[model samples]
Target: MSVDTATATAPASATTAERQDVAAPSDRARAWLVLLLAGAFEVGYALAVGGSEGFTVLSWSLVAVVFFLLTLYALSVALRTIDVGIGYAVWAGIGAVGAALLSPVVFDETLSAAKALWLAVIIAGVVWLKLADRPERPDDSDRAAHPAHP
Candidate 1:
């Protein structure tokens, strides 16, 4: 007459091994790498869209579509392990910073010093978010309490 909470909460097909694999450090690292790639693709997509001139340019439109698909796939993969909010904010920050920095070279756009300063702020925020996502390590107090037995 009693229900097993673990089984009740987990998906029917999920095994202990599967859960462990999901939490593996390597998997988390790979997810973050994939997220960075996704952000790169987002920059490409944004530039291509601008070059497309409202999709009038056939080549640029095609390029934009390809980058769009690539970015979406990579984002979904990363979100499997990363929190959606953190993953999305980092991805967007990368795209915005990249596009702003490259606009002059790519499209004869101007990047004023003021804009550059704001972009740096965004970059700093993204870096902080990434740092915040790191797994917590035991502090000195925790270490003192649980001394290693050698």
Candidate 2:
């Protein structure tokens, strides 16, 4: 439900600074509009997953999967204008925490105080990673070249 997901990345050197021309306020507004749509989709997904039963649950899972991917897409679009670390931190932070809270509030799920504390610690770690803005990706060229990830 937290939609823990990753973004596809090319080598940092392969990234080029591209210029975008938005001549109209409508375009800017549309960006926010899509963001809202994506959030709405996530909430709907969480609700569906909570309510679903039987084979319907599988369908609901698929819906959640699509919603999660769409969320990543929206985050990518947002990151076009925002810092990658900031955008990633906010997206995952809000989704994970929001989902955890909704599980209890909307679905009558138990959120034991200990579990909540552990989740809080994980969120804090994410915040730290965001602040650090890791300068180098782990060396993974060999891993990428071979499926075994030696």
Candidate 3:
């Protein structure tokens, strides 16, 4: 999950001065890994909240709020260099489609070739955006949101 793709369309007026400072690439990458962990932490939420008794849903709800904050922070890092529109589109699109498939696999929910095919198409779009856009990284003056991952 590279951030460059999410930061393509920074405001032109945003001079080097306005750029939110971030840590080094390795640090940024580490932060993102935490974000990823936060996401993985959410799988439990679905199981707990997807349809549970009363308090379980409330507990999962609070957990979900935390997950949302972490996810937003991670996206902000990615969007620094990546285009916001592309970044969000890919993020939400890929997430929704993947979750759809994952639910079936993990929870024994229904799945069909047709649904899988559509999800494949959507994921392909994500790959294509990554390839086509090639958003720039932060300038030397700017803080790095994520360290280089590969």
Candidate 4:
């Protein structure tokens, strides 16, 4: 077996820079957009399921299934870039608020002032979570391998 010592001992800084370059802002933006699309599908699935009456209604049941799969796929794609915790919370918040607001029209459900206030709270929480998140990038493992000062 031939050993490539030169490649093995390449400075860790190069790896760190490469990873940093990989975490592009455009990718993050695309992730957020995909997350939003997933949330929208969530709302669609919820409404379809509700209308399906436990799969008793064939057309609505099919719609629900399609939306459910789409939601999962979109969420998984977004998770490649977005933090799972923040991504999921935001996704759930969007679905919850959207369904709650939409239920009245779709299913003749009720939405009181208290419900509105709670939905607003959920929105605020999602915003707060997003703002609190640190920009994603490679961790300090590379730095640990090769101390910055050294």
Q: TM-score of each candidate?
A: 0.77, 0.46, 0.57, 0.77
Misplaced by over 4 Å in model 1 are: 1-22, 136-150
lDDT of 4: 0.81
Model 1 agreement with the true structure over 58-97: per-residue lDDT tens digits: 9999999999999999998887767778889999999999
| lDDT (Cα, tens digit) per residue for candidate 2, span 1-150 | 453222223333443221112112354345445554555556656666666653267877777777767777886665554345554555665566667867787777889899899779867975675455322332577458644322
lDDT agreement with native, every candidate: 0.83, 0.56, 0.55, 0.81
Model with the higher lDDT, candidate 2 or 3: 2
**In model 2, what lDDT does residue 143 have?**
50
Could you give candidate 3's per-residue lDDT for residues 28-147 as a string of tens digits? 445434434433444444444453444466765676566556666666665554456666666676456656767876666887899889888887987786566442557655435444
Please give the ranking of all candidate structures by TM-score, highest first, separated by commas: 4, 1, 3, 2
C-alpha displacement of 15 in model 2, angstroms? 1.6
Answer with 1 or 3, whichever has the higher TM-score. 1
